[model samples]
Target: MKLVRYGAPGAERPGVLDAQGRVRDLSMLLAEMGPAQMSPRTLAALATIDVERLPLADAGVRLGCPLGGVGKIVCVGLNYRDHAQEAGMAVPAEPVLFMKAVTALSGPYDDVQIPPGAQKVDWEVELGIVIGTRLKHVKKEDALGHVAGYVLANDVSERAYQTERGGQWDKGKSYDSFAPVGPWLVTADEVGDPHALDLWLDVNGQRMQDGNTRDFIFDVPTVLSYISGFMTLEPGDLVLTGTPAGVGLGQKPQPRFLRAGDEMRLGAAGLGEQCLKCVQS
Candidate 1:
């Protein structure tokens, strides 16, 4: 089932997409899509409800981040070989991890604010994995079993703060509205072969990044297990598998960074798409 949250930004209520692709209210059945609701047993129970019978929401309503109670937003860097090559870096033997402040979270379609004193804003289209259960020191073979689902995410970055300032990438990555996630949370069962999906990004109607997950140097199970080895993975934690090649900074001739009034649209196959506009902070 494609679960979602809809309505205004802070007032969004729980919802699910019905068979006809219409947004149906799930308020009466559950509080929201969080760790508790995403558990295998809870999701199994929600499957019994007749989605068609739920009230159809007005198509004009705005969509919000699909899940609530996001605990941590972990990111993997240079997970794609082509991306690593473009950035002039060697593919690491282990996943390069970083953290994006949870405050960076915003509705998928919300405006992306170019922070004050910021230049070289860039876009990264990635596949985000949502954890459903606690896990630590799990084997690669069993890593994916802890995932609740997947969603589309835009890992917006500020190059100057990320590289020139002399600190971890986290400083450049964790900004308000930097992490636009959702449209919907697609369960793992419905997303077969996660590594084979096609993903792309466009800036102001111009296709900038076009790549497939098959190019990932570290696959889903490996990434999850690797991270869990160092830290306990809790429910509601999100892991953003890195973006592919074609980011603005990697462009030839000249770099094309995001500016005020720029727009970005990105998506992963089956997870749905996100349309965000950039505005001055």
Candidate 2:
């Protein structure tokens, strides 16, 4: 089941993507795709609805971040060993967690805003986990049970603000339009094994990041459970599982960065794709 939210930015209506790739409105049944709609119980109830009877949305409309009322966007850095190596950083003993301001959330195909004086803007294509229930100190075995679904995300960053600034990674990562998520919030069942999926990112139609989740140093379950041990995982919260090794910063002697009018295309198996146009804000 591919859950969706469509319409203009601030006035989205809940919907779902049918098997043949049509959008079926769910707004009549569920007013909004928020914490209530994101819960496991609500999802189960939603599955019982006959999609064919639902109104067909127009051919092409703006898709908002699948889930609304998102509380926070958590991220695990260097979860992929190769990514850590490419960044010339040591493999962390545990997941290196960070928070992305929820305001950064944007529609999948939206243009990524380049902040003023942004010199080292970069991109990190990552798999985003959506929490279904509140969890705290949960065991590793129960981690998957708490996940609502997965969404494709571009963890856009500004290297200078992330490193050069004498502060945390928040400024570099939490800019508005920094996190463009979702073509769909694919249900866990449809996604099958998140561990073996093929995920990649292309810059201006050229492939730059290509890797599988199998190489993750600390897989999804561990990362989630590890996080739950310290912070409360609330429904509608998103967790980004980190990117592979091919980020622009990982390039040879001279690293490349995003420029105005540059395009970024990325996707993962089962999950849908995302296309972002970079622009100066």
Candidate 3:
């Protein structure tokens, strides 16, 4: 089922998209789609709910990030060969891991904030994996068993703070409204082949990123297992697999960075789209 959260920013209520594509309220059944609801058992129980009988939401309610109680936002850098080549870097033998602060999380359609003093804001369209159970030191063959579902994610970045500064990449990545994640949280059972989906991103109606997940140097299972080797993966922890080619930074001659008033729309096959406008902070 395509689970979601709808309504105003902070007051969003749990909901699901019915067969007719209408948003049906699920608040009476679940508190919210959070860490607890992300587990396999919880999802199985939620499946027993009869969406047809649920009350339909009003016509004009806004949509929020599909899940709540998000923990760490871990990201893999340059995991795509083409993206790595465009950035003038070599494809690493292993996944390059980094974390985006949870505060960066925002509703899918919310405006993206171009933080003060940031000049090189850019966009990255990626596939985000949501963990359902605790995992540590798991083998690659078993890594996928720990995932609950997938969602569309925009890994917004400020290149100057990321590379120019002598610190970790998190500095440029963890700004407020940087991670716009979801229109829906599609369960793993529905997304049969995670690596075959197409993903794209547009800035102000111009397509900047267009690629597929098949290009990922490190696939989902590999990435999950690799990270588990070092740290414990918990429920609600998100892993942004990586971005495809065609980012603004890969443009010829000079890079095109995001500016105030710019709009972005990104999505994956079956996962749904996120539309956001960039505004000065």
Candidate 4:
């Protein structure tokens, strides 16, 4: 089932997509699609609801981040071999982890504001994992069982702040609108094989990044398990499992960056799509 949140930004209501590709209100059933509703049991229960009977949302309603009350947004850097090669970095033995401030979260199609004086703004299309259960030091074999769902994400970055003026990558990664995720929170059962999905991103109608999750140097389970060992993985925690090559910083001849009015379109097969406009703050 495709889970969603619809309506205005803060007042968005929980919804599920019906077979006709229409929004079906889940407001009467779930107050918010937050941590409490992310567990395997909760999701299983939700799956049993007859979406056809639920109230249909207004046509063309705005979609907000699919899951609410999200915890820390953890990201794996250079987890894709191609991305590592393009960036002139070697693949690490362990997952490279970083934090993206939760405040950076925005709707999939929302306008992404370019922070003042920022240059080198870039895009990274990646598979996002949503934790469903509390986990600590989980084994890789068991890690996937704790996942609630999957969503596509764009890890927008400012290279100057990230590599030049930064102590940690968070300085460049944590800007508001930097992490636009979800058109739907596809259930784990529906996704089936997260590592095999094809993902791509385009800037202003030009295809820039085109890659598959199968190229991930450290796959989802490994990244999740590794993260759980260092810090507890709680429900609703989002993990961006890295992007394949073709980011603006890795462009041929010269690097390209986002300017006001630039548009971005990206998606992962089955996870849905995101279309964003870059705007000056």
lDDT of 2 by residue, 1-281 (tens): 99999999999999998878999998878889987777878889888888888999999898989889999899999988888998999999989988899999999999999998898999998999999998899999989999999999999999999989978888899999999999999988788888998999999999999999898888999999999998999999999999999998989988999998999999999888999999999
lDDT of 4 by residue, 1-281 (tens): 89999999899999999998899999999999999999888898998888899999999999999999998999999998888888889888888889999999999999999999998899999999999999899999999999999998999999999999949999999999999999999999999999899999999899999999988898888999999999998999999999999999999899999999999999999999999999999
lDDT, residue 86, candidate 3: 97
Q: Tell me how far the alpha carbon of residue 41 in candidate 3 is from the true structure, in angstroms, after superposition.
A: 1.2
**lDDT tens per residue, model 1, 24-117:** 9999888777778878888778788888899999986788889888989999999999999989999898899999999999998999999997
Better of 2 and 3 by TM-score: 2
The candidate that wins on lDDT is 4
Q: What is the lDDT of residue 33 in candidate 1?
A: 74
Model 1 alpha-carbon miss at residue 220, Å:
0.4
Runs in model 1 deviating more than 4 A are none
Could you tell me the lDDT of residue 89 within candidate 1?
93
| Global fold similarity of model 4 (TM-score) | 0.99
Query: How much does each candidate deviate from the true structure in C-alpha RMSD?
Result: 0.9, 0.8, 0.9, 0.7
User: Where in model 2 is the C-alpha error above 4 Å?
Assistant: none
The residue pairs that clash in candidate 4, if any, are none
> What would you estimate as the lDDT of candidate 4?
0.94
Task: Report model 3's TM-score to 2 decimal places.
Answer: 0.98
